[model samples]
Target: MPSPNYFKPSHPPTIANVPELTPYYYDNSIRMSPMERAFFTKIAKKDKSGMVGGSDEAQFFRLLMHATGAKKALEVGVFRGSTTAYLAQGVGDGGKVIGLDITKDYLDEVDAEEFWAEMGVADRIEIRVGNAVDGMRKIYEDENGSGTFDFIFIDANKDDYDAYYEWALKLVKPGTGLIAVDNTLFHGAVLDKNHEEGRAIDTLNKKIHADERVESSMLCISDGVSILRKK
Candidate 1:
């Protein structure tokens, strides 16, 4: 069974109401609690990909890894390394996580080394720069020589999803391997019918469902995510 749908809000709440209910991500904009808030607040101040994954999304990585015992894991995006740290928390000590991204430098303003150290699981992550699909290929090669991965998170460019899906599947075992695709809901626009991202995701979701290699479920969480586990 897949996680409950939360991102595709039947009727999105208002931010200016008496209770001031903002969007799922909007609530994180304001910070408190000193260090934890400071870290997130710093990411919020940026306009670029400095902080990509919100807490809810990061928790997806953490919980899924925990549930799957994903010692050998892969992430197709590494913006600012915030999500990387979250995965590190899930696969700690003897476990390892491979994170890849196209960008060489993200949030260079922040102290990357110190932040991971503060998180205390810095040693388990390996970051690489290249096309995410290409990076997925490298992990396949690594596993061919070593062992298979337990899980993979696909949060790279949405346009290349089909290619990433093909490559990521090769790195894990069928029926046990887990894959999650980000931005599947495409911001409530999947209902719009004419929007580009929505149309593309709608088409892709159909293909994913029909594919014999996996059983998939789309969650309305943090931009419409889909979780797939090989059948």
Candidate 2:
């Protein structure tokens, strides 16, 4: 059985129930530049996977970056570069966002480099194509065996969540850096007995909860997001 608190909502989802409030709420709270707006629209029209992070979730990421004063970030998944663009924007001038993906096909399809240039964040974003684990390990070694990132976002294959978290600890600054994992609730599938991805996510969720090296909170923002701050 799944943990009782696993699927609980962090807050009421009135807007979720009422779809009309989506645009209204986003217009009022989330600010997107013209380039960002164009990029989202382009992705929606072209990409059919629907894997892009939602507006509220993107806003939460931006807020987290601002709150932590994060200048360096690492993103484990770079799906179509939507969230990567948001990460770049969040880090601001002279900041850097390292994005890792299993393939370069999606990044090419989205013309990510050109888009980043238009957004004036080309220098701040670097796309590393290959296995995420290997890329993360290289980053750790390159940092001279010390934590170098202020923030890390993991949203890759669910089965590899634990591995990503383990590496994230080595890459993040203790007591200050934040590690945010997406889709922890897995669309409430964590309650299903036979769902492989859900089971993997649930395992990581429990592990994070009991981890003495970090302070954690699980919020049901979009599918579910778990934030961990290492001590």
User: Model 2: what TM-score?
Assistant: 0.88
Q: Which candidate leads in lDDT?
A: 2
What is the lDDT of every predicted structure here? 0.71, 0.86
Candidate 2 wrong stretches, greater than 4 Å: 1-24
As for candidate 2, its clashing pairs are none
> Best by TM-score, which number?
2
Superposed model 1: Cα runs more than 4 Å off: 1-36, 49-51, 142-147, 191-196
- RMSD values for the candidates in order, in angstroms, are 5.2, 3.0
Q: After superposition, how far is residue 150 of candidate 1 from its true place, in Å?
A: 1.3
Writing each residue's lDDT as its tens digit, candidate 2 over 1-231 gives 445664655544576567798678777887887998888888887755567777678778988898889999999998888888878888999999999999878877878778888988889998888999989988878756358899899999899999999999999999899999999888888978799999999999989999999999998677789999999
Residue 38's lDDT within candidate 2 is 85
Can you write out model 1's per-residue Cα lDDT over 1-231, one digit (the tens) per residue? 323654645544343233344454456643333544555666677776433766677777688889877787788887777777778877867988888888746735555546777777778888888888777776667547122777778877777878888887777667777888887766566677777766766777889979987888877556667888877
Give the Å shift of residue 209 in candidate 2: 1.5
